[model samples]
Target: MSGLIALLDDVAAISKVAAASIDDVAGQAVKASAKAAGAVIDDAAVTPKYVNGFDASRELPIVMRIARGSIFNKVVILLPIALLLSAFAPWLISPLLMIGGAYLCFEGAEKVWHALNPGDGHDSEAHIQGEGGGVSLEESRVAGAVKTDFILSAEIMTIALSAIPVADPLWMKALILLVVAVLITAAVYGFVALVVKADDFGLGLARRGGGMAALGRGIVRFMPGFMKVLTIVGTAAMVWVGGNIVIHGMHELGMHQPYQWIKDTAAAAALAVPQVAGLVNWAVTAFFDGIFGIILGFILIPIATKVINPLIGALRGLFGKTEKAGH
Candidate 1:
C-alpha cells in the first residue's frame, strides 16, 4: 500500500512537470511570434493582393491554397534550413538576418519612392491585374504570393530563431519554432481570410440578421476604409520593423551612431511630452525608425533597380536563363 501511494505521488509529479513544460512551450511560442510580428503583418498584407481580381467565391479557396503553400514554406522548407543554420553555421545567422533586413528596407523604400514619383513601370502592376498569358491568372498570382511568402517567411523564421532562448535544447528550440511557424502562418492567413471576406460577411449579416442589421450595414460601409487603413498601418509597420532590424544589426556588427541617434531623439521627444510620455516615446521611436528605413530604402532603390538588377541579369544571361524582377 505504501509503495502504491509512492507511485501515485510520482505520477502526479510527472503530470505536473509535463503541464509545466507545455506551458513553457506555449509562452515561448507567443514571445517569439511577437518578435516576428512585422514579418507576419507584411505576410498578411501581401497575401490579399493575390486574390484581388478573383471572383468572391474563389477568394477563400485561393487563400487556403496560399496558406497551404505558406505552411510548406515555413515548416517543410525554412524550418530545416533554420535548424541546420543553428546547428552547423550559427555564424551565418547574423549575415542572413542582415540580408533579410536590407530587403525589407528596399521594399519599404520602394513604396515611398513610388508615392513620391508615381511614374514607375506598369508591367509590374500588370501581373496583379491578371494580365499574364496562357496559364490561369489565379495560378500566377498564387505562385507570386507563395514566392513573396518565402522571403517574408525566411525573415520570420530567422527572427523567431534569434528570439529563442539559447539555454533551451536544440530540440526545444525546434519545438518552439514549429509552434511559431504554425501559429504565425495561421494568424496571418486567418486575418487575411477575414479581411478578404469582410465585405461578404457584412453583406450576409446585413441581409440575414435582425436588430443589428443597421450595424451590419455600417460595417459594410466601413470595410473599404478599414482595409485602406490596415494597408497604411501594415506599410508603416514594415518600415518601422525593417528599419529597426537594420539599425540593430548594425549595432550587432559594431556600428552604433544611427542606433544612438535614434534612441536619443526618441528620448528627447518623450521628454517633451510629459502627459503621454509612454505613447510619445513609442511614436517617436517608430517615426524615426520608419524615417531611417525610408531613407535607406530610397538609396537602395536605384542601386537595386539599376546595378543589382543589371548584375543579376548579366549573371542569368551568362547562365542562359532570364532573371525575373521582384514584384
Candidate 2:
C-alpha cells in the first residue's frame, strides 16, 4: 500500500510539472507573438489586397492558399532555420533582421511613393501575369504574396527567437518558437479571412431586415474607409518596425549613436509626461524611427530598382538558360 501511494504521488508530481511547463510555454509564446505584432499587422493588412479582384466565392479559397503558404513559410522553412540559427549562427540573426527590415522599409516607401505620385509608372505587379491572363494572374498573385510572406515570416521568427531567453534549453526554444509560429499564423490568417469576407458577410446581413439591416449597411459602407485606414496603419507600422529593427541591430553591432539618441529622447519625452509615459515614449520613438525608415527607403529605391533588381533578373535569366540546356 505504501509503495503504491508513493508511486501515485510521483506520477502526480510529474503531471504537475508537465502542466506547469505547458503553461510557461503558452505564456512565452504569447509574449513572443506580441513582440512580433508589427509584422503580424502587416501580414493581415497585405493579404486582403491579393483577393481584391477575385470572385467572391474564390476569395476565401485564395486566402486559404496564401495562409497555407504562410504556414509553410513559417513552419517548414523558417522554423528549422530559426532553430539552426539559435543553435549555431546566432550572431547572424541581427544582420538578417536588418535586411528584412530594409525590405519592409522599401515596400512601405514604395507604397508611399505611389500614393504621393499616383500614375507614376511604378512597376509593382507587371511581372505577375503572362499569356494566360486570369489563371496566371491568380497563381502569380499567390506566389507574390507567399514570397512577401517569406520575408515577413523570417522577421517574425527571428524576432520570436530573440525574445526567448538565451539561457533556455534548445528543446524549449524550439517548442516556444513552434507555438509562436502556429499561433501567430492562425491569428493573422483568421483575421485576414474575416477582413476579406466582411463585405459578403455584410451583404448577407443586409438582406435580413430591421436593425441588423442597418448594421449590415453600415458595415458595407464602412469597409472601404476602414480598409484605407488599415492600409495606412500597416504602412506606418512597417516603417516604424523596420527602422526600429535596423537601429537596434546597429546597437547590437556596437554602433549605437542614433539608437541611443532615440532612446534618450524617448525617455526625456516620457519624463515630461509621466502620466502617459509609456505611450509618449512609444509615439516619439516610432516617429523618429519612421523618419529614418523613410529616408533609408528612399535612398535604396533607386539602387534596388536600377541595380539590385536588374542583377537579380539577369541571374534568374542565367539560371533559366542553364536549366533549359541541362534539360
Candidate 3:
C-alpha cells in the first residue's frame, strides 16, 4: 500500500510538471505571436483581396491552401533556420530584423501614398476565378495564394523568432516559434475563411425568415465598408509596427542619434501633458515612428519602381528567355 501511494504521488508530480511546461509554452507563444501582429494583420487584410473575383465555391479552398503553405513556411523552413541562426550567429538577428522592418515600412507607406493618389495603376486583386477550365483555374489560384502566403509567413516567423526570449535554450525557442506558427496560421486563415464566406452567410440570412434574415442583409451591406475599414487599419498597423521595429533596430545597431532624439522629443511632449502623460508619450513616439517610416518609404518608392523593378524584370527575362530558346 505504501509503495502504490508513493508511485501515485510520483505520477501526480510529473503531471504537474508537464502542466507547468505546457503553460510556459503557451505564454511564450502568445508573446512571440504578438510581435508579428503587423504582418499577421497584413496577411488577413491581403488575403481577402485574392478571393474577390473567384466563385464563392473556390474561396475557402484557396484560403486553406495558402494557410497550409504558411504553416510549412514557418514550421518546416523558417523555424529550423531561426533555431540554427539563434544558436550560432545571433548577432545577425538584429540586422535581419531591421531589413524586415524596413520592408514593412515601405509597404505601409506605399499603401498610404496610393490611397492619397488613387492612381489607376496600382495592382490590387480581390476575386480569383478558376480559369475557363474550372480545374486548372482552381489549381492556379491556390498556387498563387500559397506563394503570397509564403512571403507573409516568412515575415511572421522572422518577427516571432526575434520576439522569443534570448536566454532560452534553442529547443525552447524552437518550440515557442512552432507553437506561435501553428496558432497564428490557424487564427489568420480561420478569420480569412469567415471573412470570405461572410457574403454568403449574409445572403443566406437575407433569404431566410425572421430577424436573422434582416441581420444577413445588413451583413452583406456592411461587408464592403468593413473591408475598407480593415484595409485602413491594416495599413496603419503596418506603418506603426514597421517604424517601431526599424527605430529599435537602429538603436541596437549603435546608431542611436535618431532614436534618442525621437525619444527625447516624445518625453518632452509627454511632460507637457499633465493629466495623461503616458498617452501623450505613446502618441509622440508613434508620431515620430510614422514620420520616420514615411521618409524611408518615400526614399524607397522611386528605387523600387525604377531600379529594383527593372532589375527583377531583367533577371526574369534572362532566365525565361534562355529557357524559351532552349525549348
Q: Name the best candidate (by TM-score).
A: 2
Q: How well is each residue in 88-121 modelled by candidate 1, as lDDT tens digits?
A: 8987888888778778878866766666677777
* Candidate 2 structure lDDT: 0.88
lDDT (10s digit) by residue, model 2, range 269-298: 999999999999999999999999888888
Ranking by lDDT: 2, 1, 3
Model 3 stretches astray by more than 4 angstroms: 1-14, 120-133, 271-277, 321-327
lDDT of each: 0.83, 0.88, 0.83
Please state the error at residue 279 of candidate 3 in Å: 3.8
- The residue-level lDDT of candidate 2 at 127 comes to 43
TM-score of each: 0.89, 0.94, 0.89
Residue pairs whose backbone atoms clash in candidate 3: 49-126, 52-126, 52-127, 53-126, 53-127, 54-127, 54-128, 131-137
Runs of candidate 2 exceeding 4 Å displacement: 125-136
Q: What does the lDDT come to for candidate 1?
A: 0.83
